[model samples]
Target: MSSSQQSKLIRVVQIIIDVIFGGLVFASGFLILWIIFTPLILKTSDISITASIPVAIGANDHPQLPVEVVGATGKGIRAAFVSDAQGTLQLETTTWSYIIISNIAKLLTALMLAYIFYLLRTVLRSIRAGSPFAPENAVRIRRLGYLVLLVSFLRPTVEYFAANEILNQLTITSPSILLPSPFKVEMILISLLILIVAQVWSYGLELERDQELTI
Candidate 1:
């Protein structure tokens, strides 16, 4: 494509990405507020818990949890709110640790996403300015890689403890609650790929600088 056409295309895509990013930030912020002020707004001290099943199942049928919620028995319970709850919404001080840890991870995730978005936008703008091999872009990409790797491990570790607390406290019969592993190889692979790209980008920047010096 022509230079002008490429710039326009990049601009359009950047705008679309920004819109999505904005929505994500807003939702993250709102949910965080809800989690914090849950006692006042919901008039109950209900600590929110979101649990997910493994993506792949064993040979046996999906373990069904005996729950009153619709599709929970068959489909299995994904998320359950734990509180001294039945007729009233109440928060237990004992479970406060779970809420705090979970929310800290949430806040980190939001910040990471915002940082990634900023780096991506800056890189795109550099490309539109015909400086795709700029040194700063390499640095940004490296930072992005590090950010992903850091969060991949850190968030999971934070969640492991939080989930452990819940499991130790409550006895979930149908579907058991388990602590998640801290090591995630997939995110490590992704971070390596990003770092590799950054290295290649840095090489290109060096070549560009050499060309300018020769001229």
Candidate 2:
């Protein structure tokens, strides 16, 4: 293919990759919000406590749900409207809405990481094709990589605090017949690696641009 054709193809691929990655990131966030907030909404509709119970006592009573926020002083406590099987909304400070939210956040963060990897691969492919060094590309790629790394770093905190394996099935399941977690992660990494390669290619394109200008 002519250099121009090759460049066009690279741009097309980059656009496609961006669309897919953006979708995944958006979906992950949506799912996370749904998982975290749905239960609380249910609880709010269900429970109503008359007074604040000692957090320690309530936590022991309801181990499945934990409602403690940590801080420098000690454990921070807040009252929440919770619901149970009975159609009564009760106030409960010992309610564990955080667990639900944390589980979703963890899974969403993981998916975001995967998307970042995919974006990286697209960037690399573009670079390999001798694309011009557009600062926009570099800034975006860097921002995405940093964001993914930051999310991954926070994942452990979720595991440490709430540590619920709620969305493990949803997350672990293959979204497509051709894609599994291993494959997905692999593709994402490859995409990112390609993006890095693209940077070099972009340099060449700049040189080409300079040569063209001289001619």
Candidate 3:
């Protein structure tokens, strides 16, 4: 595409980033207020917190509903269903502490995301100004990479602790599964890829300087 078209596309993307950044800021603020004061503000027993958790169903947990069977060929083998094991967990409590515990991770993630997008918007602004290889952008990109890595680990860690707190306050139930893992391989890979891109950006900035020097 021509430079003009590319500029327009970049501006459009920047606008989208701005929208997302605004939303994140708003959400983070809302969560903080709700966590700190909402319970005191709205005193009622109707409040319920809902979240999802990894779970496992026992081998015999399948529904007993009969279904049409084909001609029996091989012997039926016992099996069970496993997934990125997940189930919904809901708790009704008027206690403010539990509510805060349930939502703290979401708040942390949202604020981190807003910061990421803020860096992204600055990078895009530089690109839009025709200095796509600005040196500071390399630092910004590296910061973004590290921040994402932190988020990848931070999110699950916080969630695990928060959920564990709730679990500690309750009784155990059947069909148990492990809690969510602290490490998500895919997110780890993405952070590494971003770090690599930051290195590439640094190289591009070096080349930009060399080209200007040569001129």
lDDT of 2: 0.49
Write model 2 residue lDDT over 13-115, tens digit each, in one string: 7777777777777777776776666567667776432311111112213222333434425256354433211111123422445335444544756586656
Candidates by lDDT, descending order: 3, 1, 2
Question: Which lDDT tens digits does candidate 1 get at residues 81-174?
Answer: 3322112112344344545555665677777777787788889888878889988999999998998888788777765555555556665453
Clashes of 2: 23
Ranking by TM-score: 3, 1, 2
Q: How close is candidate 2 to the true structure, as a TM-score?
A: 0.40
Tell me the lDDT of candidate 3: 0.78
The positional error of residue 116 in candidate 1, measured at the CA in angstroms, is: 0.9
| lDDT at residue 73 of model 1 (Cα atoms) | 43
What lDDT does candidate 1 reach at residue 214?
100
Q: RMSD, each candidate, Å?
A: 8.4, 17.0, 5.2
Error of 3 at 58 (Å): 7.2
Each candidate: what lDDT? 0.65, 0.49, 0.78
Candidate 2 lDDT at 37 equals 66
